[model samples]
Target: MIKPFSVIATRLVERTIRINQAARTFYACEKGSIFINFGVIVVPLIAVVGLGVDVGRGYVVKARLSQALDASALAAAPYADNVVKLQAEFTKYFDANFPSSFMGVDITLAPPVISDNGTKVTVSASAILDTTLMSVLGEDTMSVSASSEVTRLITPLDVVVSIDTTGSMGSSDGSGTRLSSAKDAADILVNKLFGNETESDNLQVGLVPWSAAVNVAERGVSYDSGLNTFVDGHWYTNNSPVPFITEPDSDWQGCAYARYTDNSNDDDADHLLYDADVGGTIWEAWEPMPRRVVNPSNGNLYTVRCPEWGISKLSGTKSHATDAIEELSNPTGTTTIAQGLVWAWRTLMPGEPYNQASIKSNLRRAIVIMTDGLNTSSYRDAYKGDLNVSEMNDRLSAVAAQIKATGVDIYVVEYHVETNLMKSVASATTAPYYFKADSAAELEKAFEKIGTELSELRLSK
Candidate 1:
C-alpha cells in the first residue's frame, strides 16, 4: 500500500525546490555587486561636468575683462605721461575690472613709449589669472598681456573733408538726406578736430565740396587769390576796369554775380542773376568775364585781393557754407573722385609756396575721403560722355596713392563700392581705415565712426 514509487517521487520534488532557491540567492548577490561597481564610475563623471561649468563662467569673465581693458588702456594712455602715471592708469583700469587678477600684475613700459611729446603715453600691460579647474591638472595660471599706444590728438589736424555734394546727396540716406547727414557728420568732425570750445590756432580744416569739380570753400579763397575775387560777389574782378565796387554812389550798385556756373546749359543762367551784395545791389550786365586763373598750370591769375572772412566761428554763427548748400537745389552733377582727391591735396600741401613745414610736422595731418560711387571722371578726360567707370577708377587710385605718400593719414569710406576696387584705394593709406556703408543707417554709423576716430586728446594743454 505505501508504494516505493510514491516515496521516490516525493524525494525528487524536494530536490528540485532546493536547486531553484540556490540559483535565486546567487543572482541577487551579483546584481548588488554590479550596482556598486557602476556607481564608482558615475561619481567622477559628475564631478568633471561640474568643473566644466565653472570653467565656462571663468572664460566669460576673462572675455569681458579683455574688452574693458582695451578701452581703459586707450583712455589711460593719454594721461600716462611718464612711467609713474603709466603704472597708475594701468592699475586703475586693471583693478576696476579684475581686482583679484591684477593684484600682482607685472607691467612693463618701454621708453619713447610716451607720445604727444611725452605728454601722453603708451605701455604694455600683463597679468596672470589663476585657473579654478585647470589647477587640478597641474596648470595653475594663464598669462595674458595687452599692449597700448596712445598719442594726444590735440596737435594740429590738417583735416581735408572731401564731401560728396553731388546730386545724390539730396536723396534720403539717413538722418534726413545725404547732404544733411553729411553736414551732421561734418559738424561733429569739426568739433573734434578743433575742440568744441576754443579750437587751437593749429587746427585747420578745408571742406572740399565736389560734384563734377571740387568747389573751393570761401575759407580757402585767400590761398588762390584768383578764386577769391570771383566768388566774393563780384562780376569780373573786384578791381575790374569797369569798377564793380566804386566809392559810394556809383551807377552800378555793385552787381550781384550770377549764382550758376557760366558753363551750365540752363537758360536761367543768363536770365536770373543772384544778388551777391549783402544789400541786394544788382550788376548792370553779364559780360564775358575773363577766366580767373583757377589753374596756375593754365597761366591765369587773379590780381585782386580776396577778403578774409570766416563763414562760421567757434560760436556757431551764420554759416555761408550752409547757404551755399541751400543754393544748390538742382544738383545734378556726377561725381569725380580724382578732382576731390586733388582738392584734398591742395588743402594740405598748399603746393610749394604755402606749405608750412611747422604745421605739417607739429600737427596731425589727416584726410577723410568718403564716396558712394566709383570714380567716373578724370582730369585728363571729360566726365560727360559715356565714361569708362573702370578707367576713371584707375586714375583715382593713382591720385590717392600720390596723396598718401605725402605723410597724411587717409580714411577711405565706401558707401556702396564693389569689393575689388574699394580695397585698392583703401590699401594705399599708411594707416588704412576703411568702411563700407551699404544702407542709409550704415552711412550714418560710418560718419559717427569717423567722428569718433578724429577726436582730439590734448596732453599738455
Candidate 2:
C-alpha cells in the first residue's frame, strides 16, 4: 500500500517545475518588447544628428555671404550709386572674398539698389546650402541671405600736381613725346575736376613744372645770412662780392634758390624750404644756359635764365590750369627732384613764401610727383652731391617723410622709367599709390586715376 504523504509530495514537486518554466517565457516576451522600442527611438536620433550637421553648414554659408555683400557695398559706394556701374565691381569683390568652394552650394547675387538721392547703395545676396544628412526630412537645401548698405559721402579734398620737366622728358615713346603726353594728361585731369559740369568750389589745383631749378616768380623770401655763395667751385660772400651775375637785390627777379639741407640737422629752420636766403641752394649762380638770345642792342652778349618752368599757383578756374600746363617748355639742365618736391610743398603751405593753400577745416592734401628718371640733384650749397646715389635716395626719403608728417600724402607716377628709389618715395607716404607708365596713354591714365582718387569718395555707411 502506497503512503498518501509520498503522493502529495510528488504533486508539489511537479507544480513547482511548471511555475518556473512560465516565468522564463514571460521574461523572453518582455525582452523582445524592449528591443522593438529601441528601434523606434533610433530613427529620431539619426534625424537630430543629421539636422545639426546640415544646419551648421548652412550657417557657415550665410556668414560668408554677409561678408561678401558688405565688401561689395563699400566698393560701390564711391560711384553715383548706380547699380549698373556697380554690378561688375560687386561681383568681382564678392568672388574674391568668398573665394572658396562649398559642397553643393549655389550662390546668387541681386543687383545693387540705389536710394537716398544716389548717396546710399544696398547689396543683396543669397546662397543655397544642400543638406547632407538631413535630406531625408523632405528638405534638399537650406536658403540663406545677406544684405548690406553704405552711404557715399563727399570728403573735402586738395591736390598738388607736380611734374618733372628735365631734358630726359624730351625722349619720345609710343605715348607720343613725354612732355606732350604729360601736358595732355594734365589737361584731362583739369577737365575731369572742374570741367565736368560739377560745381567744385571745394576743389583747387596747382601746377609745378620742375627741372634743375624752380622759379617762384618775384616773391619775398628769407635765407641764411651766414653761408657764402660758391661760384665755379669758389666760395665767397657778399662782403667780397664776385661780380659774375646780376646783384641779388637789383636783378634777383623774384626767383628762389635751393635751400641748404644739412643731413645732420635738416630739421633745423635753416634746412626748412620755401625760404630763399638759406644759402642760395635754388638757383645755380645765374650761369649761361646753352640757349643764346641774340639781341642787337646787347651785341651778342650772354643772357641768364632760371633753370625751371614758372609756377602757377593753386587756382580753381579751368583756363588758369590750362594756361599753366601749356607753358611747360624744354629746358637744358640737370635734375633736382628734391627742389621740386620742396617747392610743391611750399605751394601747399599756409603762410609765408607762396602762401596759397590754407586749411580751416578737414581736407585731403596730397602731392603727385611724376618723374621719368632717378633723383640726380642734391643740396648744392652744403652737400653738393657729397651724398652718392644711395645717399641721395636716403635724403629724399627723409624729406618725403617730413612732408607726410605735416598731414600731406605723396603720390608718385613713374613714366617711361621705373626704379626702386621712386617706389620708395611714393611708399613713404602710403602704399600702392605709386603708378608706373611705359607709354603715353598709360601715363595719362595714371594721372586721371590719381585725380579721381584725390577727389571726394567717402563711404558714409
Counting clashing residue pairs in each candidate, in order, gives 3, 10
Local accuracy of candidate 2 as per-residue lDDT tens digits, 1-461 = 21122232343345345545644554566554766655654554555556667666666777788878887777665444235556887888888988648555677888887774555678888776666665554555667777887764455556678888877887775545688888888877776455233335566678777765665552113222254465665433333222223334433322344433432424322223333232435422332122233445545644333444556776656677777888786744456677567667777666544466747487777888888887664333113223466655665776677787787888898887887777776744333388888888788778767655665444443
- In angstroms, give how far residue 117 of model 2 lies from its true place: 6.7
lDDT at 285, model 1: 33
Local error of candidate 2 at residue 430 (angstroms) = 7.8
Candidate 1 minimal-lDDT segment of 10 residues: 305-314
TM-score for candidate 1, residues paired by index? 0.47
- Candidate with the greatest TM-score versus the true structure: 2
Candidate 2: minimum summed lDDT over ten consecutive residues — where? 283-292
